[model samples]
Target chain A: MKLFSVEKPGLYTTYQDLGRVGYLKYGVPASGALDRFALQVGNILVGNERGAAGLEVTMQGPELLAEETFVMAVTGGDLSPMINGRRIPLWKSVLIKKGQVLEFGQPRQGVRAYLTVSGGFHAKKYMGSRSVYEPAGLGRKLEKGDELVGEPRQQKAGTGLFFTEIPDYDRDVDVRVVKGPHHEQISDKVVSDFFAMTHDVSPQSNRMGYRLQSDLATNHEANVISDGVPLGGIQLPGNGQPIILLADRQTTGGYTRIGTVIGPDLPLVAQLPPGGKIRFKEVSVEEAQEAAKQEEQKLRIWERFTR
Target chain B: MKITFYPLGEAAVKCCFHEDISTALTYNIQAFCKKLVHQKHVGISEWVPAYDSVAVYYDPWKLSYEEITNVLVPIANEMDAHEKKTKTVITIPTVYGSDYGPDLENLAAANKLSTKKVINLHTKRHYLINMIGFLPGFPYLSGLDERIAMPRLESPRQSVPAGSVGIAESQTGIYPLDSPGGWNIIGRTPLKLFDAEKEEPFLFEQGDYLQFTAISEDEYKQIQREIEKGTYKLERREESE
Candidate 1:
């Protein structure tokens, strides 16, 4: 059986799939990979279906020992990767020797990273996912002496291809959004300032949501009823700062929502790390849908390549 | 009439139980939610039950917003009749005061009442769990004796241990998980409020009746050990009107 054993985990790390759906009623947050784009790319490189469980490493990754599988590719968040004391290239598939020690160093760029094996790693699927939500203390994160078993694919099967560098890779990005239903409730200025201005990602950020510093000169807090909020919903609490909801955000909220991040640019927002600067550009629903269509087409084209 | 739908985007639809928040309306809305949850209507993924409003989320591809509201309004009307029907009173066994109640002295002093009198007043009123929020199974209860109504602690504690029984702004609840919270911790319950491992994670849900009993600290330790060992058998007493 092919597997990789964990050596050391750097910061916060977990085995995340796309997310846990159909369980929000139970108050369970859809815990999963923060950056779906990187996870999807990594899964595709390994010939596994997109949304497969992969190691979502924070800043740096853990040292692992491969049991049998040779080819593995890592994408998103540049980090120093070493294979058995020899430097290994990232954003491309590498030939890992049997019993080789693969270690990761500090991130050269971005906050989170993804590590994918030829076959996907195996963990207990909760509800319908294998993701580990630390807040609820579910599933497992890699630690020293821990083994990650995978459903190894045959070597002769998929092509062991590699890439030189990741495209569209960056630390921060300007997010595009569609206005919300409560958009009219808030001051015209809060909406204008949020759209026309730039904001910085606060250090107090996590998988649940990103706390963003507002560009508004003055502050106005409102006592809004807690209501349901979506993944990309931008909620400006009593404080002026806009807290952009993310993949693992609460199922509901009461704060005044500025807008949603739409579909296409969601990936770009996901790749951002704390302390990264980002701006918002408002777009109509039609524009958001068109962008989504383009992304869906891109996925379909890529699926035809190695299949 | 223009119904406010898609307020939170295509994910959810907002149906006002009433413009004003009322306990009676809360019951009516809760009844509506209970029926909806039972039906498991197509595309409706999760239904978050609250005091005066119910935020219903659905799969956009399954049904459009307008279509959902059509089905929601009619089904919600059934709640008015259902509320008048037979209602179940769920009594929750709570151990009040002592180490089980760490802030008992403080709570008593703040209310200018003896700890024994405070216990009697608290147990006398039948509480209604308006909703569950903040954390998993942290029930938001109403019906506190007006004599005991007090504001939350001036400074919210950074960490309140799990099973912490706290009161804040006329609401009482037990902390389901150990996390940073601002609730005025009056006491702690040895009973597990939430257990992800259990089939029913939340010990209490909306509309459940709560009656706290005074248990000694010695009994508190026994319950804690039982909870840890997974042998905590909670006693459910016969319902009394």
Candidate 2:
């Protein structure tokens, strides 16, 4: 039903899912929800598929007016969701009636938030995903006066869905990383300095990458043969600044990549605000695998609990 | 080609080949990529083959890095034992110089050659699709004539139109989409390299061979119209080899 009409599109709101997979060879970026954990939780709360497309509100959120009855859940950065001027709790399903306005106030924590409804947001699936990848012209950011359709009701009203452990958006973040394929190409001093320094997220950081700034001057030539760049790649351009590739990163890059953030810890970088401080810690591949396994187990338990 | 496997994050593994960019390395990369896809490895999500490396993104839940590396080693080594596959040859019609090619005169002057000679040198050799990156459907081509090798612009244009045939250093390629690039454009093609709405989405695949056939501006417009109407089909044939 075309019930959810966007009254005020927030700062950079778009529809995203679990990314468009299996198209990297064509240079397509796996555009998906930056905070996958939050998106899964939000979807599960509303009894939707894990890969279902949902609105990813960044910093600010849209003022949506519902013209029908539906169940919705807000996850990720607590963007202060409210219904009809009354604040609503996050991490749990809430009911919305006809003519009710769903609005968000200033973000209380984190940079991105996910709003998933019963029956996923209906969007044109391009290359196996409903994610809005502006580069490919698949879909674009949410604009005012846009009518969004959702699936017919497949879920009943839900309640009492809450996580015991909420992600702390204000905590000092240590982004765990595995050494990149070309880590040896850089000087040992540069590597040491990189780990020792506390980097601040640059203002220009986006879904493509997080450009970090540090006072340390890393004077090294970072000219490597162009090669495949994986998600979370910490590439150090010739300018000594480090850019950590993220969800919308290019398929390949030529700068020297020193390390890649571990999979489980990617959400920490994703949730970090523009002025957030981050320190990199190098860990073994085995450690990264263990962390990912633990995260999966936690999500599985959460999924079961919500069900 | 000697291959070495390295862990990339928790779910991906990167296979590094030779450090140099050569046709042999590209072929080895392609052979392994083809074998990997044909074998239908269970957990492999995607394989991105660039200048000298292939980064395989996989599902950690279904497969581990060690298991993936173990399966990849033998497949990479036994690539030659498998039957050699034929490549798809694609002809890209291009309009060189004038408005179609804003930098053709400067490129000719930089190479100490006439515009006609530059066009001949570019069209004489077939280009190998070494890698696909930078932008969606943008092919990184090789086999450019070193004599006409031109450096990239000091500062790249804010935006270059799609289908622009450009050269940078010793490599030549076409901008599949309107993106910011530093390559020196010498011509424009009439083909739409990327259409996200299409079922296939991409016109050319990695390892496909491309031959540029120069055409007049009028012909370029005609082909463009046909492409818009879905009447123009990109000419393709199986390589004799």
Candidate 3:
């Protein structure tokens, strides 16, 4: 069913899901929602599967015209979404009739937002995913006049997330990290200096990785033989700057990775806007796992209540 | 063949094979990956093989880091116990020199040899796919002849078309997609290295061998037509270890 038509394609809007799997060996990166937690919450609000394909809106949001009555929800980064000139609440499901126009204003919080429809966005799946990985020519950004479609799913009653469930994206975020494979290669003094410094998110940041700008300089030789790079791995190149690999990072890289951002803290890292300040804190692997367990538990609880 | 397990993060582990880069090491890693895949451990999502290590990614919620390490240790220890599998070599039909390879003349001039000599050197040896990375379906091939090896372009081309065969610093590779590259272009392949629509999206895999065969420009056009007609059959052969 035709759900909406793109009137104005906002800044870098693309369809995304949980991303492709089992193809990393072929040099494919797992391209998906940068903020996976927000996308899942949007899916839940609209009564769709957690991994449903949805629009990943950047700082700016697209202006869409509804083609039919459907339930939709916008979550993650407050880009100020509105329908028919009236503002809509984030993390809540709302129904829109045909001929209604949905648009967005200034981004008050967060760097990315997700717009999910009831049956999820019906985008072409490449290698079992609708995620748009532009470099590979898998999919391109949504453009003006593009018609958006969704599977015909029965509309459930509208719902909203509890106040406590909604994440606060407009705040100082301290991302936690675990020592990577080559963590021991660097000197202890350099490592301690790195943790003590605050970094600014470089403007060169994108889906591939976030390049951080810091004043700390080290003469450490950071180049290693190209090896497997994990998502959220913090790589230090020759310049002594750190690049945090993200959802679209290459399968292997030649730089030395100092540490990997814990899985639970990735969403917070993803939400950090350009020029945003970030601090890094080191934690043990066991502690990171415990945090992941708590996050999973919260999702499971939300899954039951949303169902 | 000692393999050490390290935590990449909560969701993945890096199995480091403390060995130098060699065809033997690649085969051993391939053998271990083959055995690991057969286990089909739940929550083990994906694994990538590199020059000297294999990174195993799994869902931490379903499987613990220790549980995955336990599953990987035995397989790494017994990897050599299994017999070596047959190797498959895929032939890539390429057109060397002329407009197809714009930098062929410049590369020949830099190496103090004719374009024909460079082409012969490139096609003589079977290159090994050490890994697939940098771009989707882009193979990091090894075994370039040192005689013709040259440095990458100081300023990379804004857009190197897909199927461009190039050489850089004792390494040769083909760009699977139209991407900005710095390698010295010497030839072009008509074959699509990656087609997302197909069941097997990538034509090459890590540990596989590739042989480039020179073809005339007319033959290239014919092969491309056959590919568009869905009638082109890739030339491949299986060699016993």
Give the true-contact fraction for every prediction, in order.
0.16, 0.79, 0.76
Tens digits of lDDT, candidate 3, B1-241: 6889878878889999888898888888888777767988888989999899999988888887778888888888886553666888999999998888988999999989998999999899888888888898988888889988999899999999999999889899999999999998889999999899888988878889999999999999999999889899999899876
For lDDT, candidate 1 versus 3, the one ahead is 3
Model 3 TM: 0.98
Q: Per-model i-RMS in Å? A: 3.0, 0.9, 0.9
Select the stronger candidate by TM-score from 2 and 3: 3
Query: DockQ, in order, for the candidates?
Result: 0.28, 0.81, 0.81
TM-score, chain B, predicted structure 3: 0.96
Q: lDDT of model 1 at residue A43?
A: 77
Compute each candidate's TM-score over C-alphas: 0.87, 0.96, 0.98
**Per-residue lDDT over A73-169 for candidate 1, one digit per residue giving the tens place of the 0 to 100 score:** 7777777778888767656666677888888887777777788877777877776788897666677667788778777665533343335325464
- Clash pairs, candidate 2, are none
**Candidate 3, A51-155: lDDT as tens digits:** 989999999899999999888999999999999999999999998889999999999999899999988998999999999999888899999999999875667
Winner on TM-score (1 vs 3)? 3
Off by over 4 Å in 1: A80-95, A105-109, A126-128, A155-167, A284-307, B1-3, B7-18, B61-84, B221-241
Prediction-by-prediction clash tally: 2, 0, 0
